[model samples]
Target: MYRQLHNLLLAAVLEGQLPAGTKLPASRLLARELGIARNTVIEVYENLRAQGCVEGRHGSGTYIADLSVDHIIEVPRPVEAMPARPTISHIAPALSQRGQSLIAGAGFSRRQWGAFMPGVPDVREFPARVWTRLQNRHWRKAAPERLSYAPEGGLPALRQALAEYLRSARSVRCEPEQIIITTGIHQSIDLTTRLLADPGDSVWLENPCYWGLRSTLQSLGMVLQPLPVDAEGLDWLAAGTRPAPRFVIATPSHQYPLGMVMSLARRQALLEYCRLNGSWIIEDDYDSEFRYGTRPIASLQGLDTNELVIYIGSFSKTLFPGLRLGYLVAPPQLAGAFSKGSAELYREGQLQQQAVLADFITDGHLTAHIRRMRGLYSRRRQCLLEAVQAEFGEQFEVIGNNAGLHLVVRLPDRVDDVAVAEAALRHGVLVRPLSRYYHQSVAGQRGLLLGYACVTEAEITPAFAVLAGVLRKFVKATSA
Candidate 1:
């Protein structure tokens, strides 16, 4: 009752109902008027006075403090009476050109989880109990080192574990010293780009690359050369006219959005080309695991005897996206600098989480989880393929279905994939328009990227049916 009364009086005073210098009634009078005890009234008055909401004089009764005497609170205005604030154009721009560009070209979708959302894994099957146990084990220790800023190049134990894993699993040739832990693929790329390529330095990018990859490079002011990607992989320097780039980013294991493994010939040629021209290769190795009816593709970095390749891999696709853990295998020469730069730039921390992840990897959980998910994702991918085939038949061509979490369903040149994707979103299905991945304007290879890894086998057919219906509408319009 006292608190309620005190709050009411404070609100009234602040709201300007009980204006400054307005004398409040005596405690006895106020108590009688409000049907409360005089002691309660006196206590409420004392509280208000203590809080500077009210003041008292010896002879005169308590009064509302002159709030306007210092800082004044503006009273609430009626909707129509309030003045309109300036929009982005009217006010000084809060962000720089690069910041604005980054926001405008953001590839992240608001809907992270749903049917056919590309490049996401089903986190439901992640071994939470096992993870929690490892996490808690370290928390129990409460070591200052575990809680402090991560050392240069992140947690050493994680890096050593990753180096062992990469060497055995992906055939990446690197010592533990060469491995630099990162939050994910984005940070790895950013760190590499800043270290290796300067602003305006030519960097070869595979056409129809990951949107995030392209946007990041562009924001950094690197000159992007969009090379055509065929069934074999990125067709670099076809004309032999353009100058060699400082960096070349390729998804050799599985091409992003268009899941084609880069052929051995192409990988060799790219390595030789970069070696001779003093260029670096960025092997994304995107989703090399989960290959349906195929052997694991080796990393391009393993083939590089000259050590020109900077291999980056993300646990986001393999384990779960929320983990935000990834690694970069830098060349022996640049490894130390990369580590120093990562620490300097990001002030890297999260040692405890990294420790937990290291434990997850070393304890055989990482391999075990991948083995389980491989079969599951393979089935889901097949389901999505069958669903698309059942509905669209020969009207759409499904390419890039061999490896990776997602595949591209190609449409006729006349169809607008963006429009189809938008219509699908309206029906509560999420998909990425293939055209959105291309950095350069191209003539008609319109397609949609459908991810099945996150969705169950049952969900794939139904969700794809919704998307197929949307595609059919667009196809009909295109034909007309």
Candidate 2:
């Protein structure tokens, strides 16, 4: 009853039926009028007063508070009673050409976690308790300095921790001072593109590269040269005839989607080519941790004698994507500039998180987590492979399965991978079409990128069965 009375008065006040500064009826009078107890009227008035809807003087009755006229006057009417809205006259502002292109080409899914979602790690396997404990430790005595905006290159301790880890784990050569922390590879790449290259300058990218990176470069107005990826990864010979690029972005440790590790000869040639041509190499060493049955490959940055490579890595895969922690190993000569640019351009801060991460790395939690995930992912990868083999026999070819979270299944030329992917999604499976990754239509392949990392071993067979059914229908249709 009190709720009903409170709502009634609130509506009246908001609708301006009881205008601001107008005195409400006395409690006894309002109760008698509504045929309710005086106590209920008192409660309603008290609630209104608490909500700033009304005010009471020491000896006077309650009156409506002075709310803005605009708020009170703009109450929405029922659909049938509302008048027609005015037609828009002037043209609304639109996105820029580059912005439009980005929107058109955006490939990231809103749903990142599900069966066969590529490039996503099993975040469920992450050590949440340990991470929470570390976070708590930092916050327990979070000094004013710790809570404030991070120092120029990020939290000093985090940078040092990253430098040490990279040196030992990935064979990336760099001192602590040369490390610049970033939110993730996107920011790291953005910093490289802005600081090193100019608009209209040529930038060489892997033919079927990560879409997000390609979009990032395009948005910055760089002329992207999509070099083909053979078994060796990024055919440098094919790119010899083209004009020298200002920056060459390569995944030397493990090429994305295709998952091929850049050959040693190719890596060396790439480094030497960049050194001779005065070009910079942005070696994105993303997902180099989970190799199966082979010794882990070292980074291209470590082989640099001429300081031409800018190594980028992220903990997003190893720890979790939400952490958004990554680092760039810059040449000692350019560290200060990178640091200054990072501060001036992005002003990224998350000092307390960085501090916690520093402790997480130094205390051996990060390494231990990676080691455990490697074994788990390896089993899941095998499960997926067996499921695929059981369903398809030898109808398809699997590429780049020795390393990384995903493997590519090359299909016959006549097959439409995009159509198969769409059908699969309708039937509750997620797989990226290989053709969509290519910048040019001429160089596209008909294949599917199946990610087994996030999918559990138990869920793998069923998911693949659904995907296989979709594939079989497509194959039969194409053959007919």
Candidate 3:
């Protein structure tokens, strides 16, 4: 009752219905009229006073406080009395052409947890109990510094743990001092772009890369040069013919969507090319923890003898996306600048969470969780493969399934993948059209990117059945 009255009066004051300096009705009178206790009215007034919406006088009633006229006038109007909103020209100039393009080309999905939503991990499998325990432990300790803003680079313990783990697991050559913890791969990319490259500087991106990365780079005014990717990974021969880019962003461990590992020779050539051309290589080694077959591929950062690589990784894939914990390993020469830039631009702070994550890693929970998820993901991958083969026979070809959580199924040349994907969504299945990943539309080899990591064995076949129905209809229609 108090809450309702408080909200009503607050809204009235804010909307100018009860204008500033207007006296509210006496508490006793209001209570009697509304059939509530007088104390309730008093409480409402007290709350409004606390919020600065009203001011109280010792012997007088409460009065509305003076607020900005703009806010006060922001109330609903009758349809007949409503005024047309000011046009862009009357207010301010329209967004720049680059801003307009970025908004138009935005590709983030509204749904990220349903069937075949690529690049998402099975967050349900995350060790919630263990994480909670670690979090609680930190809270109980309640160190003032831990609760405050974190240092620019990261929590020292977390950085040290990450440095040791990366050295052994991903073969990354970096000290803890070289690591700068970021929110995720996106922030890492943003920081690197701002610090290393200027506006209008050219950056090489894989022809069909992660849409989010493309959007991020484009939004920052970086001139993106799209280089084609074959089975061996990014085509350097074609890249050689193009003007030298200031930065090159690649996923060497597992390329996004396509899931191709950059070949060893190609990795060396890329490093040498960057060395000679004075280009910085931003290696996004996201999700290198989950590999189905063979050993995990060593990171491209380890092969850099010239300190040309800026390695970025995230816990989003391995742990959970909501964690928002990632790290950037800059070269020794650039570490201090990267750290300072992170602080200056982002001012990122989540020290307590960092402490919990540090403990989670040091206590070996991270390694154990990864090991468990790898086995489960392997089974789920097999289920998806079987379902696809059962539904389509040998007509559809699966590519880049040897590692990573997702794979691409190449569709027939005539089939429209976008149409099939839209139809699949209607039938309660989600898959990304391969063509959407490309910067420019290319003919031949249209496909669907299907992620099985978050889907269970039972959900796999049923989901694929829906997708298969959609694909068959599209294929038949297009062929006819």
Candidate 4:
């Protein structure tokens, strides 16, 4: 009876009748449900114990092993029919699935597999209590102006705070009037893209650049001119004067997708070129605060005496995502135009959130948070690097290690990054494939861009163990 009972239990688990973490009925209850003798159930329990099928904790009943959870078994039931698959032809342009290929953060999930999605801050460490207290205080002392339509330039206090903070931290040369608060840097991108470049106007984009930005330009019908990036950053060789683009977008402090810092010579050349060509340079200073090496790179806006650069920064990377607060420091001449555009179309940013963030920066909370997260992310990067080397050995090479939350893994030409990404997802690990960033598919350079900022050191070992298995399977399949 014990042998028969053990077989039945195993069969139920494998058939998806018993889901992972679902507590088993007590011995008495199980005996009654299956019409078995109490002794039979007890003997079966002992047999399962020996096989490690289930574990019982004090005060907690026996639970199904996580590894034992099988695929969901379809059972016939009278219910509404599921919707059919969406057609590409019917999708609206504004809401189309075109740019969804760009890997942003892993979409929200129920499983706690511990995603290493890029541009994500560890929300567990956010100073929520302090923020809430500040919010409550601001609300209680609110002026009528607080709820009313704000000045298009944004809350004056916040602008002043950001002005001082940028000067000290980013070496930015700007006045309070030059700043305009937007939702985030992405918003700033859209706004600047619309403001600077007309439809069909060419814009220089970093090759293997941030897909999100490229998609935004495409949505606006802006023509993208790919500029190849190497160790020194964007190559200006083929970026000749003909078909001259109206705008040039770059992540100067740390290039996106691949974290290459622009050299001083290149930076000066960029500024000079943009100045002479009358091109508007959009400098996205994303993730500049988390530099592991020397002091953070001085922003291109810091050196912009000719006012060719529009500097953008966001709190989404520094603080939690919910903040949704960011600012753009435009050249003095364009201030009136941007401010008016903000007034007519997108009047008034989030007043309360900006006010709180302004105080946070003013009171030094923002600085402290950056300082703490820098250390935390640095440790996570180190652990991830060691784990990757330990797992893959000479089979892999990592790039973009100096400045961002993530690094790109360059695999052998035989491996396809998209295939590797799919296998990893099946094993409950999430990662971005580097091929996703390429605008036009080019041969060679296929691999994963793994981010470790949001994951814990304890989670790395087990996560990588699963990742290693997936890679091994991928290589095996390709070779076979």
lDDT of each: 0.87, 0.90, 0.89, 0.81
* Residue-wise C-alpha lDDT for candidate 3, range 45-67, written one tens digit per residue: 88888887889887987888888
In candidate 3, residue 145 scores what lDDT? Answer: 83
Query: lDDT tens string, model 1, 379-437?
Result: 88888878887987776788988877888888777888888889999999999888888
Comparing 1 and 4 by lDDT, which wins?
Answer: 1
Best-to-worst ranking by lDDT: 2, 3, 1, 4
Q: Residue 55 in model 3: shift from native, Å?
A: 8.4
Candidate 3, which segments miss by more than 4 Å at Cα? 1-10, 13-99, 441-445
Task: Show where candidate 2 strays beyond 4 Å.
Answer: 1-93
Q: Clashes in each model (backbone N, CA, C under 3 Å)?
A: 0, 0, 0, 0
The lowest-lDDT stretch of 10 consecutive residues in candidate 1 is 68-77
Which candidate, 1 or 3, would have the higher TM-score against the true structure?
3
Which whole-number lDDT from 0 to 100 does residue 164 have in model 4?
A: 99
Model 4 regions more than 4 Å off: 1-113, 441-444
lDDT of 1 at 201: 100
lDDT of 4 by residue, 187-208 (tens): 8888888888888898987887
Q: How accurate is candidate 1 locally (lDDT)?
A: 0.87
lDDT of 4 at 206: 85
